[model samples]
Target: MIFMNMIFVDREKELQTLMQRLNSPTFELVIVYGRRRIGKTSLILRAISGRNDSVYYYATERNNLERFREVAQRKFPEVRYAREDWESLLHFLRDKVVIIDEFPYLIEEDKSILSTFQRIVDENRDSRTKLILLGSSISVMEDVLSYRSPLYGRRTASLKVGELKFRDLRHLGFSVEEAVKIYGFAGGVPMYLTRVTPPFLDWVNRELKRVDSFLRDEVDFLLRYEFREIGTYKEILRAISMGKNTLAEIRDYVKVGGEISSYIKKLERIELVTREVPVTESVRSKMGRYVIRDNFTNFWFRFVYPNLSLIEEGTYEITEGEYANYLGHVFERICREYVRDRYRVKKVGRQWWKDVEIDVMGLGNVKVAGECKWSEDVNPHSVLANLERKVERLGHTVDRYVVFARSFSTKEKMEKAELVDINDLNSWFMS
Candidate 1:
């Protein structure tokens, strides 16, 4: 087991929001949620660190009213054990900040927990106590906050904690190119990145190629925990990671009979997959394609999962050979995400014109279009001309055309567009 030092990176904004809620004059019921290992518990603990009146309870599958009261009494010794309901518990301990972590586990054990919470929240409307409920399952969290739910419209604040940004990884002491490679493998999940040390490729090789590796079983565990149709989910993810992005294409590849929208939606809710259309297209566009949004998941399906037998035998020659092809897509995704984060564009996505496609395009105050090349050398003029033609073919005028490449040969400058090599990624982030 590789033990990583617990390091808290950037959550300044989230902390500020939570602090603001805690200091509010009225009662506040806040909902915080995200996928597993995205630092939800760490964020909450950090937010409530110095508070003396805070009570934190981690609900488990076996948790009941008695279990809750037992935990609460640990923090507040004056509480009586006779009260079994949440309402009585809250009334006894009113005006004290409380946090319930893994709240979905409690609901799974007792489905009527929401109704009980609804009553507590209603009675505590004028009280100054702040109640926070945190969960990892996105679908269950949404169901608890939905209009049909008893607790709907009762929360004073709701926050969906997302993955850390690429720019934030600069604190990890990696150069632009190295950070790109690490992000390609681990994305921004704190728990995933914790296991990664220096010498990125060596770490990658051991984690993915070795039998009995923790990461080898992570995806399977995550899917099986949240979904019932494990086989169908695996097939669907494999199809998308292998480049079958469209609904029709994925359905054909999986050969499942039922409607795939629900499965895909479930994946999306858990932050595993994303549905994207052209930047110019509307949200209702039928031209959307689904892609596995998690970098680790994408990399696993593409390289590790398919070659499990070979990996088990301690041979990774085929996987190592195909990894270069896999990095091409990673490079494109990094470039597009960088443009979106740095440029603050209205829209950033891939643009497809029939058979032609531009890898990254930004439409905003300054229209920008780009192509990513994970090659030894890139010809700036040829790449610029191709992008120009594609922009023209799409009947769109771009204010700036950028080329992202590993290295450049000409040592030349362009009058129409900009050439950005791997070294310039840091400069872009700073800008």
Candidate 2:
């Protein structure tokens, strides 16, 4: 199972946009950002794979401008520099492809870097350079392009890199069950998926629970980069992961007297947290609930964050005990992805109201009511009975009914109800 390949799975759209800009005859100042390990660096590298005119420099807090200048001088020895400074370096690379990754590091080291970039973009308007400024700090990058920032109105293209789809996990050469286990933790992040192997539980114990591990500080690193106030965001995320999803529930959990709607709005904008309304309800429905949406982060907060002392004491059983419950939600997301494209399901989501909740509500040309069972040994008849009751309470008739489970003893066929087990999902999804 190769997970570190170059842009093979679900990045074709982003790669196309980048290649189109890179091959153009005009200047391009593109701003690209996403959370860490989302493959922003890999996409850019693959875009300039065979191009001999590209220079990729990763900036750091230690100040790498000198190293970047040295690299420019070494890469293009023909360009003469009158003074050894940023202006000369920009002039030297103005006609070539340049990528400065982790642009926020420079911004942190010096506030004037943004202004310097604005000057570079302005001075090289007619130059044929494709200069892309990339970073993992979503807020900082978006702020750079805001109307009040120095680099505002100078970017020709902007992109926020996103996670791969659940369907793309089939190509990783794993069995259907193993694929689900991988998705349960990695959540389609290429960097995280690269650490997957046989015996998924062992991998979890070794990588995720190890002291002084990268996974231990992963969430903290992200929070530090993204927000000035980390305590509030962490509390909010922990609250959401623990089923305190409603606005009132979250506020009560966090014990905040003021409003948390603005904090949640910022998180939603950065693709960390998502608010979901029932499919049958309007977009402005007040019955919406928030969800972390990222499987890795949710798993971290649910099992790891609360049990930090237990993890340090080397007592892994308590953390591992609740993992199955966590995978229940993961399996629901997988089933949602399965039916999202079927039955002409242009949009698929969960449906919930006061007294009833449907696991999967697929809306399109044909509406589908679905239920997902993560554990292999689930009673299909009882599950179907519950789903029918919810659909009844939903007060609307669906065009089709389907049930998803890990493995079922009977995939008994029926006109109104379809039972799709693990083998069925494997056959239908594996390419």
Candidate 3:
């Protein structure tokens, strides 16, 4: 139904690159991919917009060659294709720019599509034809670039479009708090953010938990298309979203424990979940935790998926009843992102040693330790004091202490630490 709001914020670098490719004298092979609803198609369309000379064809599951002919006819009605095969059709557009969205669909339908593209790209190395391919399936798109694939090492340029950050939501005209609270649920997915309306809680009730909601079916649509074992992946996502982060913890939470590592590896490959070690620790550290990096994905498993019955009966009255706890976790991510965004941090992530867990840590020229509180009326002094105690347990010297909260009990400044409230964050958002 094309429900995306289509505000088309950000993607300046990607847009610039795409525009630059159009001017290149040689043949251009561009690959753009990301998870669904991440604006890959939008970016391409914007690049090719207002240019009748270019052909933008969406390849479908069945009769993609026929569909290709139909779209090509719109652009070149007077020209006739010599043959019905993809090679003959694509060769017809040799001097033109052709973009095939959802190229993975064509790949699934015909396994020989890779060789077709490889032959075209090889036969047109010196030609000025620009071929841009895009896909929503991470694994399949990545495979096209793999050493084992026929089209490997052929792309002139590639871009993995990602989610927007909390700071990037300023165009919505919401207060900093409102944007951040919305980010806690919607994350940075533009599709979900566009559905957010006034009266935040009401938007949550209407847009999130409803049976017919696009978001309600989003995760399933994504997983079903990407993975073969959807049930196993969902259980793992639910386990991680519920705080079963450790391998052992996730293994215990999800009973079908054949090889949790392989499943987790697939999720990591897709960028749906991440395995994080303490900022100060090595990548191979045993204390690694698998965290869902996507806010909307986590929201689905944590709240929406588990409460389907309530949605089915249309009696889902409560919205964000337990959202505070979720935000408690989300606020940590916000502070960590802020530290990385605002400060020159060589390392930025959470740190934990046994029972002592620091919410945010940024190690650049100086080690900065931060405590994030999603509650009201925070005491910076006490938070810093407690944070100091926790930092001491790690046997390290922290050059500064920073506290981020919804609101502070006092504005009194300290020489060693800085207190940042929603207003402070809002200023950063604007900056």
- The number of the candidate with the highest TM-score is 3
Clashing pairs in 3: none
Better of 2 and 3 by lDDT: 3
Model 3 — which ten-residue stretch has the worst lDDT? Answer: 1-10
Model 1 over residues 116-150: C-alpha lDDT tens digits? 89999999999998999999888889888899999
- Model 2 TM-score? 0.94
Tell me the deviation in Å of residue 427 in model 2.
1.2
TM-score-better candidate, 1 vs 3 = 3
Q: Candidates' lDDT values, in order?
A: 0.82, 0.83, 0.85
Off-target runs (Cα >4 Å) in candidate 2 are 78-85, 318-321
Query: Candidate 3 local accuracy as lDDT?
Result: 0.85
Worst ten-residue run, lDDT, model 1? Answer: 1-10
**Whose TM-score is higher: candidate 2's or candidate 3's?**
3
Per residue, candidate 3 scores C-alpha lDDT tens digits across 201-265 of: 78887764555777667898989768866999999999999889898989998988486899999
Q: Model 2, residue 314: displacement in angstroms?
A: 2.1
On a 0 to 100 scale, what is the lDDT of residue 258 in model 1?
A: 84
List model 2 lDDT by residue over 1-431, tens digit each: 27556235878888899999999899999999988988899889889998899889999887578778767767787544536656668887777999999999889987898888888888899999889999999888889889999988889999998888877877777788788887888897888877777567777777645777776678888788788778898999999998998999999999876999999998887778998899878879988899998888887897778877877876764344466667888988888888876676988989987878888999888899999887767778888989999899879799988898877765677778888888888886785
Candidate 2, which ten residues in sequence have the lowest lDDT sum? 316-325
Provide the global lDDT of candidate 1 against the true structure: 0.82
How does model 1 score by TM-score? 0.93
Clashes of each: 0, 0, 0
